[model samples]
Target: MHEITFSTVDKPKLLSQLTSLLAEIGLNIQEAHAFSTADGFSLDVFVVDGWREETEELKSVLERGILKYKEQYLSKRHVVSSVNEHYQVKIEPLSNCIAIPSDGTDVWEIDTTQLKTENKVGSGSFGDLYRGTYCSQEVAIKVLKPERVNAEMLREFSQEVYIMRKIRHKNVVQFIGACTRPPNLCIVTEFMSRGSVYDFLHKQRGVFKLPSLLKVGIDVSKGMNYLHQNNIIHRDLKTANLLMDENEVVKVADFGVARVQAQSGVMTAETGTYRWMAPEVIEHKPYDQKADVFSFGISLWELLTGELPYSYLTPLQAAVGVVQKGLRPTIPKNTHPRLAELLERCWQQDPTNRPDFSEILDILQHIKRK
Candidate 1:
């Protein structure tokens, strides 16, 4: 067993790059585990069929691959579609240098002095979230814990910030700016007064009528539709990641685990809370935007019933049941027939069978009209 561990900014091509490196070094992987840390680093461990003599060669090849894909790993250069607007992000090879956009874009480089953090709103595997004030506007600030801040972590944070800056949708959280400085790395976004859907359902014991549930469902579907249309996969879509404004309109938040789809449009990584995770992701199978649809189905189930999926089981148990037993949250008998059918379609075992959010949005809209 060769123990190789490295941290890099999350990217779609990362797994392929590593496997290619191993093959070039004449090493066959016996077993592999790859997952993303909530703090924005991809951690991969591989058990390979190899000997001691090839260890040095394997390291060399790995280094070369890292160098070749340095930008993809460290600098997430945004695709600037405008012909006249020329900007590209570049990273110094194997160094802890910050990425610089050749031609500056609208990504705000926030001065730490301008941010005034208030009370702590919540905490997660990534870090603590706080309600803050920036530029006289209320903002939700996600401050990555000190120990989690590293060179690769910064790169990932930069990627997410730049990506959010490019996205514009009412159902998506508004990105304000980020303080990229170490020991205080923070992401700022427009504060959602109603908090997350998870909190609304679980913490507040809120009960949603069918029409209200449909409205929330439609908001999420619209936001997810926009994300999918942009070729972005929200690898960790869940009720906890869905925020609600004071108007009760839902917006998609938490892009720490999100990634731009590669040319092949397939991602191989088990990322997301296990309870809401797609079976493909749970099985470490190649997945795409359809994974998000699976998660949406779970969220819809939660909305309709106001209960957690597999609440009696631990995360590991839920994952096992989902992968081995094809366990899905039960849709209440009273649910609208159309809505029930929609949920069933979203959580189909075959990814291709899952309806795209565009189709889901139409179904939801039709239900809302009644």
Candidate 2:
């Protein structure tokens, strides 16, 4: 086994270096861990050979590379026996218990009980999303693990559901209801049988057509406008959080990490997916509703290109690139002029420079009307 250790005062810098190293060796990443430690930080990466028998030579190269990181802070790089960290929940399949409600709009208990506990469609950081039914209706259900759902998380979850129920917007994914039972702390939502926009755009290539893409963009902007008007900020606005039904109706889902933006500095918990975070968020600066707008801006770009912004970089790295490199998203060929303009406005460096959701919605409506 070969190990290389190092440390850095700047987390982002060290991360870039590690990524550079990984990219050089043509190594396929098996697993990786990069978390904050009390002292500084530690990152463990497991990799395998890209080509033929370069595994032994690569190990030797990594061993020699370890000395480069032993300066100010302690950084360690190593090859261990398949470095696998214990992810909090161990989830299994939730039997496909689907029931399409008579109303064809909502789901009920009789629908949930039929869930095959043995099957799981998808799992997120906070919960596992299952494909269950209401009658003839198949829906995706997000159930929080008993031990994992803390008071704070629950508060977030409840507030999100409440806010969702209050607002009836096209872009916003409508909330069903929570399973009140203990241990089965679950939220039944509109079954976006097709899954998240992230999966659709990146994973499900060839699925999106031009009109559908623009339609999704228009829907998302409307949802953002709704939230902003309601004085809410979706801290975790990303493709993964955006759900799409079979009809291709896109709804913004998962407001569990969202917050009501009253004052500028409304800090809740350090919650959210890092990929979509704005630059100011990375700097630990006080952000407002516009920060959510920033995420929407990124999402819009994703919609246009069908690519995740700065996907090649770590979350921290992406944040820094947005800040330092003035890294804006690239537009795809044949993108509409109005969309290109609107997307640019959304990603303005100064959050205030970005257009508000009201204006965004107006522009989208005008574009679609044309």
Clashing pairs counted in every model: 0, 29
Q: For residues 163-266, write the lDDT of model 1, one tens digit per residue.
A: 78778899999999877655567889999999999998999999889999999999999999999999999888899999999889899999887888877878
lDDT of 2 by residue, 1-370 (tens): 2222233333444544565665565654433333333344343333333534444566565545544544433355332222112243234333233221243454334244554343588885567877776444555677876645545456656676556656678677766565644457676666776788888777777356657766887788788878887888888889888888778788888877676665644542233555677666554445777777778878878877777787788555665688778887777767789988888888888888988877887887788788
Q: Please, what is the TM-score per model? A: 0.75, 0.67
Q: Give the range where candidate 1 is weakest over 10 consecutive residues by summed lDDT.
A: 79-88
Q: Return model 1's CA RMSD, one decimal.
A: 11.1
lDDT of each: 0.77, 0.63
Q: How many angstroms is residue 207 displaced in model 2 relative to the true structure, after the best TM-score fit?
A: 5.1
